[model samples]
Target: MSAVAPVRRRRPGRARRHRQRHGYLFIALPMLLFAVFTVLPIAMAFVLSFTDYSVIGETNWTALGNYTRIFHDPYFTTALVNTVVYTLMYVPLGIAVALGAAMLLNRRVRAVKIYRTMFYIPVISSTVATATIWYWLLNPQYGLLNVFLGWFGIDGPAWLHDSTWAMPAIVMMAVWAGFGTNMMIYLAGLKAVPRELYEAARLDGANAWQAFRHVTLPQLRRTTFFVSTLLIISAFQVFDQAYVLTKGGPGNSTITLVYYIYNKGFGKLEMGYASAISFVLAAIILVFAIVNARAVDRENR
Candidate 1:
């Protein structure tokens, strides 16, 4: 009988080390960029929050003065209140419209791809373009929105100009511009749902609403959680729309927190106060994110 030769395994030697070195080299650029752009700015902002940092002037340490001032600043209070109100309006409406659109898109129809593309067009459009178009559409006197409302004999409020209606109008515009993305997300989640579940639901004599509530919603809990989280974060960081459309309004009624931060930072050049407020905003967002994640996790369990 011939002697059998045993196979030898490859050792972790120079070749493996060479590959590892190459991999590290590939990642080094991205890591360096992240450190410079993201980490460095975050660190600077945190430190600046405790100092009176003016862009082109002498600085003095303020310790917690900026933070303390936040509590007493009526502008901050108003901005905070407006932000909360915007959140309340934006979150629910955004979810509802997105889900409703998603459900509609989930159907098997001819030209469905075209419909999907049309829905997603707004997402790809520039924020500036969207604001400009909406600015024209919201012209209370000659705008198409009011013109349409006139057909029903409803007196449309001066949308962006009216303090009472300005925020809601902006919310309406944002929802239209943004919901397509969540709809696409929901559509994906809907696709992943097992067909057997829906078939089983129907066999049990469940109607459409019943099936949606029991089968659909349960399967989509994770998706809903994700969508709601994005909406909340976006709602908190809302600036561009208010900036372009209302400019925080006739009475500061639409003055959102981020807008206030922008005004302080660059408008009034109160960099330290802005930095402090921004940190507080970050903290608030963190708390909300934690609560959202925990609530969903508990329910999933």
Candidate 2:
């Protein structure tokens, strides 16, 4: 019989080195694009935030002046408050509604695919179109929503007109438009949960609520964290709906951080001040995201 030759295995150290080199190739394009579009812009904005640049021309460095003005500016304070209120209203509501919708779809209901498609339609629709439609729907005199309320002997207030109602109206529209995508995400998370856990919960005399609380929710924690983080950031950056529906009107009730930034950058041509505000928004988002990550990491442990 012929002697068989021993097969040589690749060394782990060499293999790891190859993998590390290959990793850079895969990541190079994305890193390049991010540096160009995201990192470089952020750096530029940070530098500009300390200056007195405008559409006219660069004047001189006014270190911390823009940030100092932010503290004293009543409009900035109001915008910050409005943005916070909007985030509070929209984020929780969106997550709850999306979770509810996702749970419904998780059941073996008829036409589930169609239902998911219907729910997701609003998310993919153009924001401008959605805002325009919602604007008409919330109109005081001739809106469908008011007509329906009138039928039930309830007076519907001017939704986007009165300052008290304007922000809430925008919040409602935002939730409707935003939740569907998160619902799909939650649905995917739900699907990954083990059916055996539900069976075990039932065997232990657990009710539907108990099964969900014990098994489903625990499994969905990561997804919840991701969705909440995204929604919170988006809520802080809301601008298009306000621009189209209320124009930050009804006494600046719907003005948000992003709207304020747009007014400073484009309307007033104060790029440096706008950059300062943008950095503040970035800081807020970063703090929240860090908190969320830590909370999720603790839960995972």
Off by over 4 Å in 2: 1-29, 295-301
Cα lDDT tens digits, model 2, 3-96, are 9999999677988989999999989989999999999999998999999899696568999999998889899999999998998899889999
For model 1, residues 123-239, the per-residue Cα lDDT tens digits are 889889999999889998999999999999999889998888999999998999999999999999999999999999999999999999999999999999999999999999999
Clashes of 1: 0
The candidate maximizing lDDT is 1
At residue 65, candidate 2 shows an lDDT of 100
Model 1 score (lDDT) = 0.94
Candidate 1 collision pairs: none
TM-score of each: 0.95, 0.88
> Stretches of candidate 1 above 4 Å error?
1-11
Q: How good is model 2 by TM-score?
A: 0.88
